[model samples]
Target: MTPETSAKLAETVDNCRRHAGDWELGITLMLRTHVTIDLTGGLPSVDADLAELHEIADRVGDRWTRAQVASAAGEVALSRGRYDWARAEYEECLRLAREVGAHTEVPFAIARIAESAFCSGDFDGAEQLLAEVAREVEPYGGVYDVRAYGGMLAALLALVRGDLERARAECELARAASEMIAAPPQLTAGLDNIDAVLTARAHGPEVGLAKLGPTLAAAVAAHCAERVLASLCDTAAVLLAAAGRSAEAVRVLAAATAWRAGHPRSVPEQAAVGGLPDGTRAVLGPDRYEQEAAAGAELSPAEVVTLLTGS
Candidate 1:
């Protein structure tokens, strides 16, 4: 991160913390900050940051606010690749939202729980949860704000399921909704563009990864460590392989593998392979590999359903 950007993010964090007592305003500020950090691919240093924010929400003693806090914490945990933890948070958020009659939060929490399931490779669970969320939220008026985020999740789920055409269509819908709502342009745009690039890659290798270059460059310049790392790993892998520089690709993958190993708790398994060359799996070996792989692979659909229900 640049000095200027670092200073700005620090200022934002401080300002949000200073106004933490007002649940509505605080949640909005925190959500904005979270989006910014997420786009830049940064993760919070500790769970306690989320816990502190939740503590403030609890003090407010409003059901809606508490649900929002839980949802936000679930987002943070999901971003960190703590799928089970994310599931737990969102489950609790859902229960509280339902109990308090905060219907809006119900769909939002459901969307988040679905994302956790998708990340953990429970595709059926993700689809089931999204279907339920869509149904619940659609009746409340088909507003772009609620549906936009859910659409993005749906697009991602489609991508993971190997339905490139469906994913592209859903991504276009998400992009349109995001644009309409004036969602954080940087984050949403990058994600939409990434989906496009991935779709193109699915067509052929020689079609090249050039289309992603500028966006990836912009992400790196933005100093969003998480975004930069993901973009670099993906873009470099494809470009290097296309250029016949498999050795460099391997080296880049190695560095990425090492980085993920270093931040085991923070980096997601799918993230490590996001934009890399086909057949270029990270040789992080049996022990560490099995640990993270099981974390992603062995997650049961039932567990996801239970987590979504928060029962």
Candidate 2:
């Protein structure tokens, strides 16, 4: 956020504080906090925001604010790579939001829970959850937000199942949804990173890295959660290695692993360390691979950026 926007939000927060226990003000702030988390990918500043919102949720008698707090907490859980915990929070959010009204968050909670299932490798469970969300959301005029994120998950499922054509169609839907909403880069890049993986598999990693490298850097620049960027870099490194760029790939993984050390939140993605593939380990041989990764771990962010950009 710009200095001016930051100041304005701060002032608005204070104004909301003045109206303590006011349902309208509390609800509004909670909504804004949720949007802020979505836009900025739950940066550290919102740690305090969620903390305060939780306290406010307990004090406020309104179910709407309580629902919003659960929803916002769900986003924080996602940022921290706690997928199961996130699913629980979203389930609570759905329940609470329903108690207040047929809020759109109800559908979003289901979609996100399905996403957690998808990431957890429970394809059958994810499909069931996604179907449930679709059934619920279709009747409510279909919130584009759910479609945007949900479409991406659909595409991911397609990719894992080797259905490239289905993946392509789902990715198109996801991109269209993003365009419809004019979502920020932080959100859109999730689709892009996944698309890069698909492209790398079909064509080549050189093709994938061309897009993934820059997109990953941009996401990191936006201060998105380390998990978000870590996942992207993990797949990007695989692409690079596939393109016969194992040396560079090792460096990328090493740098990404080191960067992730500061954030210390890792999703359960079938990787031994830093999300690098076991196949990559097999190809590089442990000794040489570890050496390059060690060297990469020592590089500064600027240096990593230089390597990613090939500058």
Candidate 3:
């Protein structure tokens, strides 16, 4: 469902809570609604829903519900870049899911743990967890989360290791899996970001920018996830910096940073900072770069989109 619809449903559910079961439904809906990347700020914080979930679990002594709560918490922590906490929560979710015969959640929990490892830069750990997810889901023709999310993580890990062929294969797997599930536009945008980065590395910045420009514009217009949007901006910045368009790089980077500051749960700032080339700083000089960045930060979303799309 769209984030807007989910937010509306969550609000309606919240007002109709008349019993413990209703509380559980309301809290789950609210958690799912608010945790979505696009509509986070209008609803209650995820922590409040999680706390209520925990209370519900304690009252009912339901291991399955507890496992669900852990998984939800893990997702929240991961989105906020708390890797260790996310891993711990996912592990608890896995353990409890197994105890409660929540078989469907097992592979998903493992995939998320792998995600935490990937995000934390522990590639080997991510591989191990992903392998476990593969084993768990293989008997069932593979789960969508394991295939799509895990494939994306694996592709990125392969890229970091400079294994272009493997990265391409994994990216294709992710793309196919995403298509099978008819994944959200934000997710497809993430796949596009990955593809653009790979293309930049293999071909040229101009070629990559040609592919990325439309996808980036569409993502911004769709109000995609902040993490996906940030990655797209960083990739654009990197490509621009590589192509010697240092001014454009600085503007995109600065606009992305400004946008992220308003959306606090986004990927960390350093992720974007590290993508730009050192030459960008030298080309503009530190003072001029900062001045341009400050100016760029004030650009409205429409202005930023126009700048990025060059239209």
Candidate 4:
């Protein structure tokens, strides 16, 4: 949706929420929609709605909505690269969901925890969690986010293991599932990341950058999650380095690193895929790489976009 439409919808929802006031169910639904709308635009100010939603759920004694609030909070944390905290929130969400006998919510909660694990470099744990998620979700055709992220995680794990064939197959599954579900841009960005890396591995870094460039631009334009933007920058750094653009690569890597640093406990993608390659540093040597990286660290997100897109 266009930014204009999204803004209008957000305004309308706020109006409805004011009118609904203190009506637990109506407020809950409105808050859910509000959160979705905000996240779709990659805005970072959903805490107020989430806090209010939690208060209502507590007042109403609704375990299911409580579980949902936990999941939503977890998503915010995850988007900021707070993997440990995100996992903790997801675990709470899972416990609450199971307590309420929310079968559908269970798989998605598990998928989210798996995503946290994957981002934190726990591929084995992520694999086990995703396997459990698949067992629960596949029989019932799976929920949108669950299928999309699960497939993407599986593909990423395959790539890490040097199993290109498996990676290709899983990436295809992720893309198809995302398309079928009409995935939100944030979810689509994750899938596109896998594709860009796969393209780079199969062809060359330049080809991979070609695939990644448009995806990165679209992601920035869509206001995807901060994690999405960081991951794209991470990929761009690696690909640019491989393609002989060492200075640009170092700068981009520095920006991505700076973002994670801002979050304190934030973790990047798996070190193998996301961290700047040592080879690139060796080529540039300490002095030049450090100079470029230091400059990159000072760049704002918009500046990073300009550095990348030249716009």
Candidate 5:
């Protein structure tokens, strides 16, 4: 994003925050919180929104709105890399959605759970959760993110299992689905990250790395931590390795790990991507790799951005 665009967004979010407690703007706040609160806001801001919305929704006895707020809270947790907390929030969202007969939200929550499951390396479990999303959304004839997330989960699962043909097919479907909908910029960023990594997997890592600086900037601007760390940074590391930049790959990996530890200490393990991890480590030599990784772990977000941007 341009600095001017980012400044405008910041101003807009500030205006939105001023009305956060207004009952008349409750639903708007609930909907807009995805980017402003979860993605862009600091922890105090997210927690405040979560507390107020969750409380007011319960007090007003509006289960549907409550479900939506619950889902957003889950997203806030997810952005912070608190996967377990996010799962719990999604479970509450599922429960409230079921109570209110919120058909669309029910599947949306399931897709979210699938995300956590994928992060945890439980591919079978993630598949099961996404199957529920698919079954539920099937009757609704494609409900935006719910439909697209199903395709994305399938794509990654196929990629992990070495089904390149299936991965490509599913990823294309996801990219199309995401583009068709008026989803949040952050949501689209997530899909785009998936697309970027898939490209690396397909042609060669050099191609992806060559274009990644702008991609990383865009994803970071969206404030989707998983997109930044898990998708972009992680894929860039793999690409660096493939391009004979093994030390650079090690540095990126360290940054990825550190970012997770600092922001989302509760996130599940970064599941192995085929032999990429082992191969990269072997190329660096174990001792040298550790030294580079330790150096990387010490870099802050600014430093990580510098490294990513090649500045």
Candidate 6:
């Protein structure tokens, strides 16, 4: 993690530690910090902290707060690429939300589950969950994040299914919903909008590459390591391939591979694709890198872009 991120997390942790009486608020703070860390491709220490916090919430018997904590944990796990654990956490959160009738939390938990499924290549399951969330949350007023999230998921699924037209439409909807939110741009709502725009262009590597330059620049300026690494890996792979810079693509992939090695406990479904280089694996081990190297079949430039961007 960056120094700034570490300091921010430390502040949150200190506040939570000092204010133990406010278990709900403390858990929320921890969850927010955990989410930010997970999204930025940080170290594994935060996951351990979140697990401890989860135990505390369970002991306190705060069902609603526990549900939110679980949902946030699941999201962080998903961001780290831990699909199985993420799915389990999301399922637990969903059950708790149902028991407590916490309508606001249910959609978010379901959306996280959908994301897990999508990352695991279970498009049908992902689509079903997203559709359910959209239906369930529609009657509840002011759930713009849910709506935009579902649209973003729909766009990804459509793109994977080779329905470019449908993907484009969903991206437009996501962008529109994002515009209505008053929250900070780094928040989930705004990020979903940015994701939609980038995913739409992912149909063509050239277009995606052109868009990624500015997007990565912004993410770097904001100190969003996960977003920057993701954009770099995807854009570099594709642009290099398109320009016949195979060696450069290999170099970018190597760097991404190294980053993943440092966060082995992270959610595997969300990590970069194409696995580590052979030398990296000799140092990091095969289990740390999910994908195996192919001898002759290199991914097309667009496919490389999709793998990196999760589009």
Per-residue CA lDDT of model 5 for 9-93, tens digit only, reads 5565567658554454556556546655534334445566567777778776777777787788888777667777778889988
* Prediction 6 global C-alpha lDDT: 0.61
Per-residue lDDT of model 1, residues 220-298, tens digit only: 4444455334434544455555555554455544544443434342222445355443443344434554454344333
Candidate 2 has its poorest 10 consecutive residues by lDDT at 265-274
Question: Could you give candidate 6's per-residue lDDT for residues 1-311 as a string of tens digits?
Answer: 46785688677777767765557445656655555664454545566667766777867777877776777677667656778888998999999999999888789788888988887878899999988988888788778877777777788677667787887788778767766785333443334434534553565545655565455544545545453355355445545455444544554564454555444422222333344244445543565433433311244323444544456
187-280 per-residue lDDT for model 4 (tens digits): 7777788888889988999888877777877876776656667778888888888888988898988887676556533333546444464666
| TM-score, candidate number 2 | 0.85
Steric overlap count per candidate: 3, 0, 0, 0, 0, 8
For candidate 4, the C-alpha RMSD (Å) to the true structure equals 3.3
* Tens digit of per-residue lDDT, candidate 3, span 1-311: 46677677677666656544744574555456344534323223556667776777677677777777788778777766688898999999999999988777798899988888877778798889888988888888856856887788788778777898998999999999987886867667878878998898889998999888888778767766556666677778878888888988888787776666543432323554574635677899999888878887776556756776678
lDDT of 3 at 179: 77
The alpha-carbon RMSD values of the candidates against the true structure, listed in the order shown, are: 10.3, 3.2, 3.0, 3.3, 4.2, 7.6
TM-score of each: 0.69, 0.85, 0.88, 0.84, 0.77, 0.73
What is the C-alpha local distance difference test score of each model? Answer: 0.60, 0.72, 0.74, 0.75, 0.70, 0.61
Candidate 3, position 161, lDDT = 78
lDDT of 2 by residue, 1-311 (tens): 44576678778777876865556566656756755665333456677777777777787757777777887887777766677888888888888878878667777888888877776667888888877877777877758878888888888777778789998898998788888786766667788888887787777778877888688778767656556666676776677777777877888777666655554433334432344546566777999888887887787555655676776
User: Candidate 6 — which residues are off by over 4 angstroms?
Assistant: 1-12, 15-19, 22-25, 28-32, 38-41, 182-204, 225-228, 262-311
User: After superposing candidate 2, which stretches have Cα over 4 Å from the reference?
Assistant: 19-43, 262-268, 271-288, 298-305
Q: Which runs of model 4 end up more than 4 angstroms from their true locations? A: 1-18, 21-44, 99-101, 142-145, 264-270, 273-281, 285-287, 298-311
Candidate 5 residues lying further than 4 Å off, grouped into runs, are 1-32, 37-44, 221-230, 261-269, 273-291, 294-311
True lDDT of residue 86, candidate 5: 79
